[model samples]
Target: MATGWLCHELYMWHNTGNWAQVFPPGLTVQPGTHAENPETKRRFRNLVEVSGLLNHLVQISPRPATPDEIARVHTREHIAHIKALSDAGGGDASWLTPLGAGSYEIALLAAGGAIAAGEGVVSGEVTNAYALIRPPGHHAQPNLAMGFCLFSNAAVAIRHLQARLGVGRVATVDWDVHHGNGTQAIFYEDPTVLTISLHQENLYPPNSGSISENGTGRGLGFNLNIPLPPGSGAAAYRAAFERVVIPALHRFKPELIVVPSGFDASGVDPLGRMMLSSGAYRELTHLLLSAARELCGGRILMTHEGGYSEMYVPYCGVAVLEELSGVKTHVDDPWQPLMMAWGGQDLQPHQSLVIDKVAALVARIS
Candidate 1:
C-alpha cells in the first residue's frame, strides 16, 4: 500500500478577498494580506512535487461531497447560508472567515478530498493518505464557520467513514496550535470518536481548549485537550505526544486514526507563537504513523488544517510527506537549523509542567 496525496487547483481559487489591509492602508500593518491566502498551500504542493515525493504516492481526485454527506456533520441552514453568500458575490460568514464567489463549491471539494482520503485509507487502498485541502476545517462548527474554515472537513470525513464504510471508534488528533473547537463540539457527546487537540493555551477563540472541557454525557471520557503554553518548542511538543496523545491513543485502540495536521505551530508562523521546527513535524508524523500501525493496521488519514508562513510551510509540509511516504529527497530545509536555534526550541521546566498538567487530565477521563 502507498500513501495517497489529494489536491486540486480549485482550492487555491477559493479566495478570501482582502483583509483590513494594515488598519490604515500603508501604515501600522504594512498593507495587510489575506490571512488565508493560497501561497502557503500552493507552495506546499510545489515542494512535494519538486522533492519527487509526489510521484511516489497515489494521486486522488478531488470530488465534491454530496449534500447528504456534508449534512451529516453540518446544519442545512449553515450550508445554505454559505451557498447563498457565494451566490450574492461572497462575504464574511463568521469572524475572520471570508467566502468568495463559488466558494461553496470549493469548500465541498475540500471536504470531499478529506472523505476520499479517509475512504482510501480505511479500505486498504493505501497504507495512509494525506489530503492537502484548503480552507482549513478544524475551526468550523456544526452551525458556524469561523477561523478561515467553512465546513468541518475532518468531522464530515469521519462521519462518512462511519456511515458508508461501517468503520468504528475513530481517533482524531489535532496538532493545530489553535483549539479544534468545532471538532471538539461535534463529538463532545459522542463516545465513538475520541477528539484530542494540542494547542497553545488561551490562544485563538480565547478560553477554549481547556483541560477541564472533556467530553460530556457518553463522551465524558472520550475527549481530551492538551493546551501547551505559548513558546513551546520541539521538546515540549514531543513530551505532550509521548505523555498524553500516545497514551490516549493506546487506550482508545481506534479502528482508524485521523489527524488535523497544521503547520502554524512552527516558529516562523505569523499567527502563532509556538516554536516548532520542520523536523519537529516529521517526528510527530513518525509517532502517529507508528501508533496507527500498532492500533489500526496503519489506517490513517491526515487533512490539512492551518499554516500561514508561506516560506516555511512548504518545508514543514515536505517533512511530513516524507515521513508518510517513507521517502527522502535531496532538497533539505535550510531554515530548520535557524528555527531550531531559537530560544524555545528545547523544552523548558515550565513547559513540562504544563504538559504534565494536561497529561494528568487523561487519567480522570480514562
Candidate 2:
C-alpha cells in the first residue's frame, strides 16, 4: 500500500461567487471577483504533475457522496437548502458558503473524496492518503456553512469510517489558520474522536476556538484548542505541536490520524496574518507523520481544508505531499528566502508563554 492522492476537476469549479477580497467593495476594494476560484487548487495539481510528484502516488478517482452519507454529518434540512439553492441556479447557501448550478453535486464529490481517502488508509489499500478537496469543510457546521464550506468533509469521512468500517478512536488535528469551529462542533460532545485545532487567535467567525472552550459533557477533555496569536511563525507552530499536539495524540492513542490540511497559515496567504512558510508546513507534516507512526501504525489521512495563496499554495502542498509519500523532488519554493526574511520564524519569549499555557492543558487531559 502506498500513499494515495484524491482529487477531481469538478472540485476546482465549485465557485464561491464574486465578493470583495476585503469587505466593502464600494470603497477601496478591487472589482468583485470570485473569492474562491479554481486557480490556486488547479495550479497545485499542475505543479504536482509538472514536478513529477503526481506519477509517484496512486491517484484515487472521486465519487459523489450519497445523501445518506452527507446526512450522517449534516442535517437533511441543510442539505435540502443547498440542493434547492443549486437548483435555483446558485446562491449563498449560508454565511461564507456559495454555490453555483450543480454545485451540490460537486460538494458531494468533495466530501466523497475525503471519505475515499479515509477508506484507503483504513483498508490498507494505501498506507496513507491526501484528499486535495476544495470548498474546504472544517468551518462547516451541521446546519450552517460559515467559512466557504458547504459540508463537514472531515466529519462525514469520520462518520463513514465509524459506522461502515467500524474504525474507532480517531483523532483530527486541524491546523488551518482560521479555527475549525465546525469540526470542533461536530465532535464537541463525543469522546471517541479527539479534536485538536491550532489556529490564529480570534481570527475568523470571532469569539471561537478559545483554549477554555474545551469539550463539554462526556467529552470534557477530548477537544484541545491552541489559539496562537497573530504573527506566529514556524517556531511557534513547532512548539505548539510538540508541547500540545503530539502529546495530546500520544495520550489519546487514536487508531487513525486525520488532519484538516490548510495552507492559509502560510506567511503570504491573503486571508491570514500568520508567518508560516513552506518549511513550516513541511515540518508540521513531518511532526504529524512521526506521531502517526508512533501511535497509529503510520495510518494518517489529510484532507485539504483552507488555503488562499494562488502563487504559493502549490509549493506548500508539494512540500506536504513529498513528506507524506516519501517522494523527493527538486522543485524549490521560489519565495522561500523572502518568507524566511519576513521574520517571526524564531521562537520568542512571548510565544513560549502562549505555548506553555496550552501545554498545561495536556496535563489536565492526561
lDDT (0 to 1) per candidate: 0.89, 0.88
RMSD of 2: 1.5
Query: On residues 157-228, what C-alpha lDDT tens digit does candidate 2 reach at each position?
Result: 999999999888999999999899999999999989999998999998799999897899988899898889
Question: What are the per-residue Cα lDDT tens digits for candidate 1 across 96-144?
Answer: 7888999999999999999999989988889899999988899999999
List where candidate 1 sits over 4 angstroms from the true fold. Answer: 21-31, 364-366
**Model 1 vs. true fold: TM:** 0.96
Q: Best candidate, lDDT-wise? A: 1
Clashing pairs in 2: none
